[model samples]
Target: MELLVKSIALKSPLYTSVHLIIILASAILGFLAYKRNPNNPNNRSFLMLNLSLAVFVAVTYLSNLDLLSISTQIFINRLTFSIGFILVIVFFNFCLIFPEKETKKSFVYQLLIIACLGLAAFAAFFDWMAVEKVVSGLVTFRPRYPGIFRLFFYVYALFAFWGIGILYQKIRKLKGKERTRVQYVFLATLLYIIYIFSTNLIPAYFGRRFFIGHTALGAIVFVGLISYAVIKHRLMDIKLVLLRSLAYLTMLGSLAGAFIFFVYYLKVYYQQFVDPDIVFVLASFIAAFGFQPLRRLAEKTTDNLFFRSNYDFNEALSKLSAVLNHGVVVSKLTDDLLGELKAILKAQNGLFILSKDENKFLYCLAKNSKSVTIEELEREEDIIKLREAGLEVVVNIPDDDKCYGVLALGPKQSGESYSTRDLRLLEIIAPQITMAIKTAKSQEELIEKVIEERQRINQDAHDRIYNRLGAMAKLSEAAAAQSKDKELFEQLDSGLRQTVVDLQKIVNKDTATIKTNGKLASSLKKICQQHQKDYNQAVKYSFKASNMLNLDDMAWDIECILQECLNNAGKHSGAKKIRVNLAQNNGNLVLEVADNGKGIHNLDISNLPQEHLGINGIIDRVAKFQGIVDINSNNDGTKILVSIPLG
Candidate 1:
């Protein structure tokens, strides 16, 4: 108990320096982790671990200074031990959430937390029940430690190993830079825990009386490694280490400079009459008094120098507007805007994702993301991976009442902080980008609607037109039956058949622009099927395409010629059967038609286009294609041949 009031000069120089350094480093890491994303549980737990260590170190340092009475020391020691228990739980919590947030509301997570809180509650009372004694000028261990002490140690070790196992699995599951980050954090934790065993628990196990109450100070290793990971691998992100550390370090340097300047000025004025203690006090006073204001100035100055100096808001807006106005080409606009933003912000890596639903996402682009996942937007043990791969800011692209998606920005190439100004620029751009996404989504919906409407219209036209035509054909047959005139029946049948064929051509051509698999043969096959269905008579046609016809419009012209020839054959050649031969040979297409029917009298092959309407149509079509025609007539059948040059 008397050691509590022992001389302050007995404080070890090494212990003082180590504790101070740990506090500073821990404060920096913890603060940055919290500042970057306050809503993140992973970061919150990280912050809690660091804060507990810093407070414990601070209290231990003050305990050595005789700044508290014996009772106060007892209470503070127990409270610090409680914090230590909490620290262990926080570290485990951090491990469970690495890369992203884990579901802490689960039964296992909640049970562990409750167990730690229970240990923490008992740690404050049972920890200092031993008779007052000291080891290494501090109460680090008792000769025979109480049950609560062993309990705290066991819980700490259990959680540490469990946390390490969690990190190990994550490192194995992840790849590339993500794997590297988890490995760094894992190595850092394993080292720190090993450090704790060596410096705090190992000595006690061997019954060493003089203990080193430096476990809190030894956390420098953990903090140092984590800081390295943040800067190099973007564990929580690079800006977490870069922005605040630089600004505060500048402030610290300014304070140090003022202290030195004051010290020298006081020494000069009071050379002979100098009291060293008074001089020290006065300089420290000036530096301490100037601390807050100097810190503010230094932070602002550092921000301007490192990031704000080169940033021009107007230029950024102009470039963003240029990208947005590039056009509604969805893919082009998305890729172009991502490139533009990445360049403008100078980000080291980036992810741009727009999800429409659980299964369907709008678009995804990476500015060298190292292969981040869709689930990794808020990276986790199993949630995502990019949170460790330099992700810094996630801005929601919002329009009206809906949020289309987020634009996740990675750490800057310059490792500068993503300031509010940069965020404001993103905010302005998000709405316009949302408009582009909406346009693309609307286009897809419009295409679906057009297809459905076209199908409906085609079905209606087919039903109504086919019904009316069928009724007309029935009436024509009925009239022919009553009049008993064979010539009139033939004329009516011919006119009706020709009208139906022309109408079918117009309606089918307009309603369905079928490509038929990029081949003319497929279209001709469809025409043959329709001819049989329309006239109820078969036209045996054989087609052998020797080469790919380079002509595109030739498909339609050839189809028309076949339709006219078939019509003429079916109408006048009533002797039962007709056959068509279409063959391509040596850059020329030859078509032959023959039917067993009554022959035409004095048919002119060269000037047949001037004869019957159907025959004239066929002759005209053949002549325009630069082809020759030959016709032969006999009592049994008639044969017509046509040839057209391809080149």
Candidate 2:
């Protein structure tokens, strides 16, 4: 018994024990992660590595127990090393699944696999590559053909470094939680490589077993750190497997300990040893039987801890669709979306940008947990990508297959990541959002069309009715001029003159267009020449356009408004001198009409009869095109300043 204990101690059974513990722990984590997210290639790869490591550790432990012959032990040791090499190769293949580097570089991947296979072959077949035997009661590998194994080690090191380099590069480019998770993976890989290289080198250099226990210790620490990272930060959403594995491990350990105790206690009475195999079989059965129930419990616990409710991202999108269908204003729609997103996503901040086109985005809505600048959120490339991807909802917008824009919500509370289910929900709701936006846009366009049509009809009616009345007034004046009786002639002339003035006022009120030549300055010159010939007042008109003013509807409207003001000054002001000027200043059309006339300081313009419509008509017409109208009177003259915007 003393010799057996001495052999176990000398062979470092504790090292094998710790190695088994680390392997088992890693296996549980990998298994749980795989069970929860089987499709995640990373999880699957890690699980494969864990299973391979567990097998290697178990065989190593059996070899240390000296339960098999020396030749058998040597074969198991080579087998263990071969398995480890294969697992490392598979780890690289897993990395290739979502490689940080361009995955299209197929040659690189093929070369990597070929190199791995070559190393595996050399390790398995070449006796000189790896020769294992008991050295000082501890099983160890000695390289007889150091050159080949050294070459293999260097290649393996290069591969490990390459993976670490890729992970580091990816982490540097990633932001927030992704960066942290990637960093954790890189660090874990770095520690693993360090342990392997350092342990292997220490034996080679000193010809001693200085690293036997240390390598296992390092592995234990590395795996523990990685498992913590997996759970705490939800790196790759691996927590489900990590948690379930831990639960099962705890249950199995407790059952195994109880069975061992029961066996020991029953030994004296039965005079027979209870088989450990039976306990293992029973424990495995219990664990298997409990899996479903435990999984359900885990799911419920996970729901309570991480995903409190069924976050119906689709439901929020449906509400947005209803608002849009109702033809709600864009501002109101933005507000509603922001509010709902904040609640549904449990976001720290929310931003919704509606794309006007591929390049132009409108900052339509935002809500923030803290005081955040709109500019900062607007500038993020992730937001831009979201819009570009057209992932606003699940259903595609009917008119266009492309997305209008994205409704980006969160940075969720605690910087949690959006799960696959969350992304799917967004996809499902996107179509309804697109339809709502289309409906709203169509309604707005229709409203604008109606407004434009009504304005056209009003202008047409005003021109037609007043122009005919002006002709009738002129005919009455002619008839009055031809009357023979003096009293009758005087009566007819007075009535006709009054009628003509009334018709002129009507024409002026409705028809504001001033017929000027194409060259406005030349037209004003002609108007001055005509006024000088007809009136006692010396009329002077000066017109200028800073540049060639191409007149549109608004420009025309301003010209008409000015013309009405000038006509009123000519017919009503009765000034001795009249001046009209037109010029362009500061991208605005400025027209001034001034007349030298009785100031009429006491004129109660507001109290004017309903028949007098000039002032109100000018104001209303100017207001339609968002122009400004200013009227001022002094002792010597009346001046009107009309300014209209250029569209």
Candidate 3:
């Protein structure tokens, strides 16, 4: 009863008010991020970090208040101490899995968390510092604790440094703007941790605990950087980050109004302060001249943060222009355009559907669908499928030259409605997009025609020359059988036959020569049979690939390699039997050919023996696809291995 009377007589300190504001602000920022995406582990851990900070500040401040009784004050102190360590541990956990990277907790990390939890629990139950009926009130000097409490300084330092190292590793792994934005977050977190350590732990060790109210202010840097990252770079989510700042502002406005209501309107503490009439005149003057511009500036600042830095129209235009200027492939250009636009607008998805089926294709960044046809993309919300696919704004890719298909963009990532500005930006870039599609298609068609024409001319020459060569070879063979000098005629026939084989290989240079619907197995088997008949030796062809190679040039290149290998082995290896195997291994198409004969004693793939000229051709062909060639040969036998990447 005496204690309650004494507490009532003691005036309420202003530090408690400042502490409450800080704690509230920190909590609001945390919950905002968590609520935006609770499923995201980054968001989940960030919430814990913020809540721990709030609790740390709250208890630390409340423990220093004179109104609390000795027992209550001591309990708050223990909790504050526990929360202090918990904050650092939580921060360390955050560092492990931030910016959307999944981390498997190592045994050492798990042990650290367990150790921190144990220490926190011990601190809560049993005082690390020697204390008896005392509270570290702001003005009242706290009693000197024992040396054991000082050891925790090392613990805090260890966790802080550990977090820095983990954060550094994670940041190093990132590239481009992502690394820069995360560095902001890293710097922010580092400052917060270091600030708390400098202000709280060091001061407490010296038995002069100051800056209890400032603990809340320390995390403001972190909160600001987090908001900056989100707003400027759209870090976690734009809506989540900006709303917190806006909410803080709204909260401050309400607090100011309430404070004015009590102190001025209700006159509770108004009597002792400056005169009301003079204050009212000054308040009116400030509101008239200052409030409108201040409000406008705040509004303008947020708009600039979202649009000017993040979703820049000029930058998007420049990017689209660069893509249009440099791109020769329609497929690649479409992909780059969609990706750039989606990122710039902070959009959920984007799509480009080319019309007429004349080098026409459909591309999208949407998850619901990977495909969309010209029929399905009619300006595009009119199409039920497109609306269902989450396309919110669809722009017609039409101009005087051609009526290209629609370019549709989904809703903003923040779930905000698209403005006229967004639609206009897309509108302006639509022509460049259309031209890019048209120009790429024209170039592709021209190149295809050129390839077709070249193949036609080559076929004409090959047919006439090959027939003449065949006739000459048959005549030579007849002369070899009839004439007295048979060896010379037989040698001429063999050379003619080799020339025919080389000519046939020249025709097989392009995939257009083989109309096997991109099937390697059937074509390879057929070619192997023909080669077996020519060489008059047992030849085996095995095809065992699961994933299809999508690269257009891969099939022809592989065939060329196989032909070169077979020809080299047949002519040079003097092999009786040849075994060819093709299979998929580790995302690569593995092709191996083995000849059971006297080996060529080849040492290097690039620098083969003088006689292995065809092997050099095989290596050159394989180099186009960025594939690997390994020739393992000795006195027993020779084996040629080719591994090409499969899409």
In order of TM-score, best first, we have 1, 3, 2
Q: Model 3, range 190-293, lDDT digits (tens) per residue? A: 88877887877778777665444356567767777876666555555434244436744854584457446644663445556767776666656655565555
Query: Model 2 segments beyond 4 Å from truth?
Result: 1-76, 82-232, 236-306, 310-327, 356-400, 446-562, 568-575, 579-647
Per-candidate count of clashing residue pairs (backbone under 3 Å): 4, 10, 0
RMSD to native, candidate 3: 18.5
TM-score of each: 0.44, 0.43, 0.43
Q: List the residue pairs that clash in candidate 3.
A: none
lDDT digits (tens) for residues 452-544 of candidate 1: 556434433333344335534754776667787565466456556755754665555542343434466666666565555445567787878
lDDT of 1 at 271: 65
Candidate 1 TM-score over all chains jointly: 0.44
Residue pairs with clashing backbones, model 2 = 32-241, 33-241, 393-427, 393-429, 393-430, 394-427, 394-428, 394-429, 394-430, 395-431
For candidate 2, lDDT tens digit of each residue in 588-637? 77777788986546545446565545655566677786778777787888
How many backbone collisions does model 2 have? Answer: 10
